[model samples]
Target: MTTDQWVIPFYQKQFKWLRDAEAEMANYLQIEANNIEEQIGIEFNSMLDIGAGIGSIARALDARGIAMTTLELVPDLVEAARRRSPKSIDIHLGDFYTYTFPKQFDVVSYFDGFGIGTDEDQLNLLKRMKSWVKDDGSLLIDIYHPNYWRTIAAGQKMKIDDAERIYSFDEEHCRMIDSWWHNEHPEEIVTQSLRCYTVDEASSMCEKAGLTITGIFPGGAMDFDNWTYKETAPLSGCLSYRIKLTKTI
Candidate 1:
């Protein structure tokens, strides 16, 4: 199946739990919004969140008086976001790969969802995203670190309530694979794969897309032994990193 078609079922099954946890996820989303603000290093009058899941971050930023718009691919998530968000937040339901946006924004943030298809697909999306940013605006994207994913690719397994999750990696392609299934329905499994990139590789790709990297903030690391997460870590040790990009001019 194509990346777009497969992502629907994968994400629908993967994030189904988020449908009921909007209130519980508020604090986390607020922190994410704060991090985005700090990374931007300036006030933003308007923002667009691509691949917005349930619009939590949009609501968090909107609460802070920043006008927010969101684009999401999943119909269920789009409806949930619309239901949870205020009428002022423009929540559009469409694929970022083909959607037509009405205007540009001061900042465009894409959190946790990148590298869906081929390398060329990623480059194409970056070019499209650049077009949506105002000349002086910024783009913030979270990129999975290749080294970190490589270290954890030993088919680690976890049990969440009655469901089981298996994490593996494609060393050949530098992709992270996550699969999930309920214990009672072990035969039925849903999976998603995300391509990981080194900071240097991302820089080269961004440059080709007419964007320049301004800053990179390392994301947290998961401590498998303690089953906890560290809020900050060096890029070499972090699970992912957030890159702040601006127009190449």
Candidate 2:
């Protein structure tokens, strides 16, 4: 299935558990906010979050006195964010590829949901994001790492409450596929496919889109056997990597 066809249903179904995990979500968002600050090396005054799941990150940054705006494509997620977030945050419901903002921001961030479509499609989005940042500002994005995904064995399964997820990789295309189903209805499955990129590949895409990669930070991974998450890992061993970029002059 295409990205537009799978994205909404995949996330909506997979993240249903998030609604009840407010405290845990808050802690994660706090760490994400701290990472943004540390990686960017600036006390940014304004930020725009793309694919901002439930505005959790926006809320976290907003609490730190930053003006936050969020763009999300899911209707349910947008409504949830509005209901829970403070009025100061500007939340928009639209596709980042087609949506336009009235003003540029000091920083733009996209976490966890970066690889969606073809390489050209990703490059197009990067070019659009560049226009949303002020000339002197930076953009921070989390890129899925191909190396880590390559290590996941096909048919790897995990059960969470009533739901189960199967992880697999598309070696030829370098994509990660996540399939989810309810234990009661094993016949029905919804999946999300994301393209993975190495740091060098990501750098080339950024350069072509008129952005320069200034920094790279390795992101953590999940130990499925122990059901625990490691907060830090080497670049080749991490689940993903965060990149800091600036508009090329």
Candidate 3:
């Protein structure tokens, strides 16, 4: 499929909210940006935003005077992010897993886009992404919580705008599948998979990739929604987590 074929088109429309992100999601990100900076220590000079969906976090950080570069998989969104961001920032159109940086960055962030691939793809990408970070720089990524899947599963259909999509659970592979009508041609169908992982499972995957977890932040930056360290038990209730990681143990 073409770059703007299926998923890109859906995002192109769904992320229209991102065009005015400074006015839309700024308040939410602003409330926690200071805390995130303090926790990591030292303000970022150079940063890489992987899967920078329309530069949501990139623009937000740039607004604060941090130098930013975005790597987006979609050419259309990369064009959009470029148009929306300040002239100083650079936006690269490529996949993060194979793209090489001329030098390491002070921070490497992937956000919600971390869960876009399969289980092996997720692990391999995380392993490769570690090399992009400076020795002690942070890696911020989020995964959709597995607990949320158990409660809401199978045959659930919803119309996002006018397009209809169905949700199905794959018990054998333990992945959630969303099948929706094509963005350009509603008569055609498209499928996307979202892998859900418990906090412990995700942390273990990080450990395997040579990353050390420094902290976990709540989804939406709300106190009631948070993910903490778990030994063997699965994380429940939380829908997601903002994991902060470092390259060296």
Candidate 4:
């Protein structure tokens, strides 16, 4: 019943992304580790970064002696990340939902990839993450806030010549449609859809997965408005928030 055109050539081309986002990754690593240690009174011995785009965070953590693993569904991205990571950091090319790990991690993370499915699916991911963490481990996830997302004008489309890509948002479903094509073979194009979610909705999903909110990181550099992690800290007008969670048990 869906008439929207979706393509399949995205994988043919290399996407514009980071091989090593050193500065940003380091900043996030230090801030998050500090927050986790200060609040939870412990440091993460091991970590699993779901949807680890370029292995930036994994490499960063690896440099600090933390055991790291990067999981990505895209083969191309996974290969890129693997080549860019150190030997100590393990990189796997597979879907996080179904991929099996050798052992549980002390911390599980999903940056900018939380809202890729329906409410039930998102909850399912959280549940999966729960099983992948140690009894006292943590879950760090960056989530899309509804307010700023609603401000994005839907149906507006754009094309990038250099990237050879087209993009648009289907606001009704909170999905962004992305397509890529080769300049020589424009006839063959590929596309992907990404779904976004809000704070309350993601929190409810976390509860369903037997996780509890421990802290919220609001970074302006990361599109989160300046905010202190308080019970009454307002998240309005914020594009995203890094939510920290812990297993219920």
Candidate 5:
């Protein structure tokens, strides 16, 4: 319904949602919440999952008796989420940056969907997200590390089910593209792009957004099933941050 982002219209009528592994991905977020609770010692009273896809994280949290509001850009996916999610979850379908949430949240999360726009645009989003966060609420986001993305060779292609996907990184534009099309209907191709970012860049954005970073979990440490966060990671590859954002003076 909203033409907020360039990719929104393409995804509105694309193939039936992501060929992604949703259940397993939800499990990872569950562990992440567990890890955060262990360290922060605060139960998430409410959460706003930005760019929520199929309400995976919402479902995971709902199972644990947590109240959550999920926002998604694509209408089809939002409809799918509405059909599958519990009545407890508050689902909103619109532009996340512009939509006004009804209440503040103890946590705001963006999973693997942090770098969809330019750096300044991203910082502006952070400022908007901050307005919805409670005074002590935390912001957990996963960002694409520049070092790891550089290692991936461009023009890589793969087939999933009946659809084939080609992935490439544009070094000059600093954006990564995932283009897809069905083998039987190669004529109808669709592509989605994301602007990549580094920790330093994200930090600067956070500062400009009037947010404080309490923790930074880099690399594979974000894989909840595999590792626990420890605040230290070399630029090995693919980093994520479980940052605790707070307001500045």
Candidate 6:
């Protein structure tokens, strides 16, 4: 099965924890937001959070006094986001590629949710987002780094309470695979799925979409302690990038 086929249903069920998970993810994004805001030094008047799943990222921005609009393709997720932040702004339910924006936004972002689409879908989505961003507006994104799969393959696992999920395998091959289970969740329950993309290939696609890469944060948002990327913890497959991109002239 393709990434989208699995991810869409996975998220639909996973979002059942919207009440709790959204807040957790929001806290992490806030930390990222502060760092980027300091680097950019401009108050974003409005934000377009693509694939804003359950409004976690948008809620984070909203809490910071920034107005945000969420765009989600999943019907259930969109309704959930809209309900979660009813007083905030719009929650458009459709593929962002098909959705129309009333005006340009100061910031446009896709928080890992865009990874569901195929490479061509991803490229088209990026190019579409670039058109909605105002001149010099920033785009923040998060995706697992392709290089870290090797280290992850060496065997990585974390225990939560009485359960544990582990990932182990080589990533050098184009067909890389990784899997994990929620320690506390049921065995039949869905867990993490496999996804792959080289950094060079992803960067090239971003460039083609008319955005320049600025910073690449190197840590996944697994927990509070291991959020930031450091030189010491360089070989991590489960990583997140706080890429800063801007619309091309």
Best candidate, lDDT-wise? Answer: 2
lDDT of 4: 0.67
Off by over 4 Å in 1: 17-19
Q: What's the lDDT for residue 28 in model 3?
A: 66
lDDT per residue as tens, model 4, 102-183: 7999988888656665666777788889899998888888886655455542333434444455546667887655566656
lDDT for each residue of candidate 2 in 103-161, tens digit (9 for 90 to 100): 99999988888989888889999999999999999999999898788794356788887
Give the TM-score of each candidate.
0.95, 0.95, 0.79, 0.74, 0.83, 0.75
- List model 3 lDDT by residue over 92-144, tens digit each: 99866677888888888777755665677778888878988989688888777
Candidate 6 TM-score, true structure as reference: 0.75
Residue 57 local lDDT, model 4: 63
lDDT of each: 0.87, 0.88, 0.70, 0.67, 0.72, 0.65
Local lDDT at 4 for model 2:
65
- Any runs in candidate 4 off by more than 4 Å, and if so which? 1-41, 152-161, 164-168, 176-191, 219-234
Rank order (by lDDT, best first): 2, 1, 5, 3, 4, 6
* Evaluation by TM-score, superior candidate among 2 and 3: 2
lDDT of 4 at 82: 73
Per-residue lDDT of candidate 6, residues 77-115 (tens digit): 887777778586767877666788889889888776445
Q: Model 6, stretches more than 4 Å misplaced?
A: 1-3, 17-29, 153-198, 220-238
The lDDT of model 2 is 0.88
